[model samples]
Target: MEDKANKAWTDLIQEYQIDNAIKQHGEFIIQAKDIKKYREPRLMAKWDSSESLPTILKKSDINILPVSRSAYVLSNFKLYQPFPENDINTVKYVPPLPLESIDFNNLSTESNAINAMLITGILDDFLGTNNTVETFNGRMGTNDFSFTVNLTNGGKRQVDVQSAQLEIDGGFENDDSIIIMEAKNVPHPDFHIRQLYFPYRLWCERVRKPIRLVFSQYIDSIYHLYEYEFAKEDDYSSIHLIQQRNYSFQSSAISWDDIQRIIDSNSPEIDDNYDDTSIPFIQADLFTRLISLIEQLDKVPNMTSAEIASSMEFDIRQASYYSSAGEYLGVIERPLRGHSQLSLTGIKLMRLKLRERRLELIKLIVRHNIFHDLLSQIIDTGEFPSREAIIDRMRRYNVCKDATTLYRRASSVSGWLRWIVTLPDTTEEFE
Candidate 1:
């Protein structure tokens, strides 16, 4: 049973893998909203009321300060500590990538994996920071109340889950305490653990402070993030699921069954290199840039690196994907700063723009016309239309031609069709 569960999440992760061809043929959907905001009211109410117990314990236990507010112990756990010199354990499988790398064109599993890895890296950075700052506001209804106030048996107090949303769990990880995250490509019933517990323990071993667990998932270019906080333990062993919010996908409740289904399906790609312990997902930026180059191409006029960059927002690595689309991936040069108004004939510019739009159009057309219909029918129960049969109807019908390609060298008619569609008369309605 345990084996089945673990395999389930792993499988779900793979299906969500951006590298998988399924994505190329997929129609991307916006990720879901925050989970905490959508959890059942009764469940949330219970969680909210649960916090009051801490206050109750503090008042009655009188010794709560000894356990929770020990300045001496906590101060010794200084936040201002420096990062220990790098060790083999901290070795970079992939070194830190610049945020600037985010400026790119299309998407691919490999690039998205890199991007996802970087986002996870930021969490590590926060955990490595030692200095902690307290940022809370306090107000006294009246200092006179201190004269006769009861914190124990009776007092004017109310606790609710209202603080959930505004609550930023785990301060920027004071000391070596990290919020360990296991990222996957799909939903896994057992994924809740791999993406949650294991990473928590791994990081917990690295530092004196407790490690929190997080699960990040990517489905069709969308990222879904979930977090878990442990409960109080006697031997520092038990895990208490304190707070969980599904912020990466849709506004819906996922049962234990939902997890099973996703994992049972295809899963995300995990690096076996790290003893199957720590695996990073594909990055979004690098992949997107790759896609962009494929989307826009030109035959007559060789496009300069700057022209490609303009379409890709200046990511040099991604710009290469453009020139090498379908054949090889290369990095020629990042788009130059200013070339939007470069000297070029109106026809030349039109051709370049069409080349670009065509790539996107091809992918979009395939997704709406093909994958969505097929995947939806198999995964969920929905008979849909295959737009491929009627691609002519929605787009420019009059410009029909023999063939069209995502690349620039497809044919002359392709460019003419694109140009004619965007032009006035004979073009759709407004013409």
Candidate 2:
């Protein structure tokens, strides 16, 4: 049974290898071994919530400070420098993109989406460096190498990863360096360093130019690009974030007045179709996250909670929250007694025009009682409501919580409403 379970887990990981570069890069993290051996939730005991125990041990059992020892003790550990502070004064100009003429309805594949960005000059705008394509979908290295993987949990083993199967979606040559890219459709908190490391290594051997590793995500009509480099070249685990920024091919500006109109209407006639009980009203970017969930469902319909969590590299609890949000929007369903799947609404959502989809979401929010009532009040007031005012509104609706929790929930409500009101239009301008 254990053997079967391990195989199942490995298979699940393989299924989620959307691109060859990411897949090959992940091998160093898990080392082609059972995932159970590398679970590192235990390292979070010192700073994680006091409400629950970590997966590997009790808080009292661990003696070392996690800030210093996390990488030494946990497999797939990520070490990041201080986050880059947002500087509003330094905003760069985002020129118009070539995506204006492309039809999003037919842009289903990752390669196609990537090509659109390239042709549209998004790469140059976001990275602040113009580049020409050097190679696309190419491989290097011979298939005859085995290395010992030093496990974070104090173990070492040999594994054969034949020739490093180095693949990159797009390689760009700028003025002084080559940028090796690994692209994904979803934005993740962190990525396997191997994705950038192996390619950087292979190319360094073939060319004298400096190599820069880039991870790109195209989501919700915006492009998020991150650049990374290994602190110690040839060290698969030395990846660190150099810089990260978000850019939109078109402006995503939305105004408070625009949101007021939606709040004052009955376009979304309330119905008994939504289930808000299991959904959190306080999550960050809940609407966009829900849309991302729908995209995953569109790719692989009828995935269980565990499968969805694994595929998206989210914790099971987080996966549940996203799935529940989809259910609340009436975009997902469970035709089988125990299995969850996309409903007719979700399918139609995938097929609709992008503008139509955003409108549908606005209508859905206006149709929900809590969102509708609260937003109506906020809209009626000429200014942004205070946190106290928001919490008071929540209290009136029986969404009561403790002081801290209420404050956080209120912030979420304000942010989400702002996001809804400011939903970007599909209209575009060509350079």
Candidate 3:
């Protein structure tokens, strides 16, 4: 019965081409990867070398030292330590913290997965630990964060959506709180506008107060919380996307850090084509700082001075002192120059890049790999794995890596693959 129903819906969509709504713009995809490959001896050992997070978070309680900008924001709004309670349809905003030490040792895939499972009902375990979030199931009006519906008198009753989110009766919340938490499994990037708009419309049409949109995701070890406010008070549902005509991006929630990287990853060639009206509101210097914050390491797969220079695309003369620059940036510390043995920092950095940056780039590489595989199976079984085959696969995705001035430099990071946006699937379809 369900299959028949789904077929009918699918037939209707295809008949009317309803998929064109989102697809008319483009499909978003992340290359699929078999994550087990990353857990090899070379990489995991280093990331695990840090003191366990339990000790780190307690000592770093000085309320500073962010592992990333997103970390900084999440730390500031962490109502978790002493869970916040909802008062009167409002949430208290925690003030920003000062920096003391970056304590990333706390982040774990399981911890993140557990958080996501709660938010989206997608997974149950995180950081190898049982998710205790179910303890708060159905309990609301306790946290400074809550979602509530203000039902009016003498109106057709609307059914409240039941989900695993902290919610409360608006009348019970304090009037001073300003932020609304909208947690999702995979909301469209413009999800901010949607989450805020409907709620804002419902509330303003009934009651009156300020609203801030918060997007939380537990995909990686970090639970990203995004804050969004309308450009103007009258601007509910008034999101002006970076590109609307092309619908280049869905309304799914996008992290500030991810958005920043997208902007940074863009090449001058891409930038030249974009008008001032396109880019999001961002600071140049902050973006530069974010780029520089790339993890430093103790050892990197040991690139010799020549190989290191070659990676940097410098000539032999330039290559000779390459490790010096790497060392200067704390990227590598070698006992002697030519030997290119890694310092502890280099080894750690290499591991960090592999572990952290994998989702961003390697998954895309997998998509590229699959594209080649599919092409080989159908297009040319004989001249398989041809250069044209690879190029064609990549081209469909708009992966213009070869066209970049710093192609070698930029392509080194796997996150570079996120820029490729030509697939026939929404991020979900790919997943």
Candidate 4:
């Protein structure tokens, strides 16, 4: 799909002399009809992030934005903004209301997660507001508006819009302001500003109250909310983060004793002759990202490798690494036909509550000899084992023979161990 889009755009650009036009005017407005000559404008223009841009546009550092219902503007401008690093250490656990109807364990969509957050009062707590009501949402046509965006060349371009379509995942209003939220279920490093900017500009014209733009992402059972503001309302590039918060309905507090208990418990021993060579050694580092990948697999069964890479915003090779890591843990089945699906074990693991799910994950990781031994050493010494020590263990177990591979895999081992040790203790109360 990406290649096809790239080819279409490349053809369109050459045929229409868009490059020359942008060179002269600093921007080029291409109508839907002109784009439709090669490909559907909707498919060609729907780049949600900078990484998703077609080769020509990305190489030229050009961004595309809808200037009107029938036209799009292309320029060498900064259109995508990176999300701030999420500090899960500061996550606040907001208990679910007694009458909550949403089954958070099976959340499959952004709407489901957002609704759960609202019902549990996570949104209200994060926003410091009460009686927040969902007022306007879904696709709406924008009224005529204009904004200025900074170009990569340190120049500015004026953008005008008339009846261009914009959608709000959720629009919540309190007495003081209207919150325009753009929700995403899959994690991405950054997002296109148009998702929030268009709705914000439209709402500002419609409402007398202040318009607050928020980006909501639900990943691995955590709802990350980021509130952003345009310092200059009419400047598209003026968007900046005001504050951000992480929230969860489940308890994120897991004590060291809890990990210790898992280490000491008597469980079925791993097969002694299990072939380590059958699967790739773990190179994917972030444990939470692994869990997030599993969650995505649970939601959409039998996803192709390409779909996984596109949906997770990972490269094809990284997708393979995570898929192999999942298979190594005996929770994912990648068939010869190239479709990846959760194994029976993975499906059952997903059904467990947050605490049990996490514990089950820990058990799965430690079931392997290397992680088990490393975790035991950590418990005994109260310190992480050295890289050399971990690499030696990998060598001894015949995990990998290549020195570079061993070092990379050792780093992954250290990362997972750190994640286990840093779990917040449940006994501590958060005020």
lDDT top scorer? 4
- Candidate with more favorable, higher TM-score: 1 or 3: 3
How well is each residue in 116-163 modelled by candidate 2, as lDDT tens digits? 667667676656777656564565543333334444445443444345
lDDT of 1 by residue, 1-431 (tens): 11222233233324444223222432111111211233322221111111111222122221110111111010011011111211111111222234565521222343353344345443343233434332221211111101111123233221111111112122234454444444444222222121232234333434677655544444323333445564532112234344222211112222323323433443323211212222111112223333334434421224555555444333333344334332212222224432112123222322333233333332322222222223333335433223442233223322223334212222222222222222111111110
Flag clash pairs in model 2. Answer: 254-422
lDDT at position 128, candidate 3: 20
Best of the candidates, TM-score: 4
- Judged by TM-score relative to the true structure, which candidate is superior, 3 or 4? 4
Q: Whole-model lDDT for model 3 versus the true structure?
A: 0.29
Rank all candidate structures by their TM-score, best first, as comma-separated numbers: 4, 2, 3, 1
For candidate 3, the TM-score is: 0.26
lDDT of 3 at 418: 24
Using all chains and alpha carbons, the TM-scores for the candidates as numbered come to 0.24, 0.62, 0.26, 0.82
lDDT of 4 by residue, 1-431 (tens): 56667788888888878888889888888999998888889878878877667777787677888877789988887888998755446677776666656676667788888788777777787788888888888989999989999888888888888889988899999998899999987767789999999999888888899888889988777778999999998999999999997877777667678888888883535432325457777887777768888988887988887888777765566678888889988899988656889999999999888878888889998887788888888889988899999888877777877788889988888878876876654322223
RMSD of each: 24.6, 9.7, 22.7, 4.1
**Which prediction has more favorable TM-score, 1 or 2?**
2
Q: In candidate 1, how many Å is residue 176 off?
A: 9.6
lDDT of 4 at 288: 71
lDDT (Cα atoms) of all candidates against the true structure: 0.28, 0.55, 0.29, 0.81
Q: Which parts of model 3 have CA positions greater than 4 angstroms off?
A: 1-6, 10-176, 185-193, 205-208, 231-236, 240-431
**What's the distance in Å from true for residue 205, model 3?**
5.2
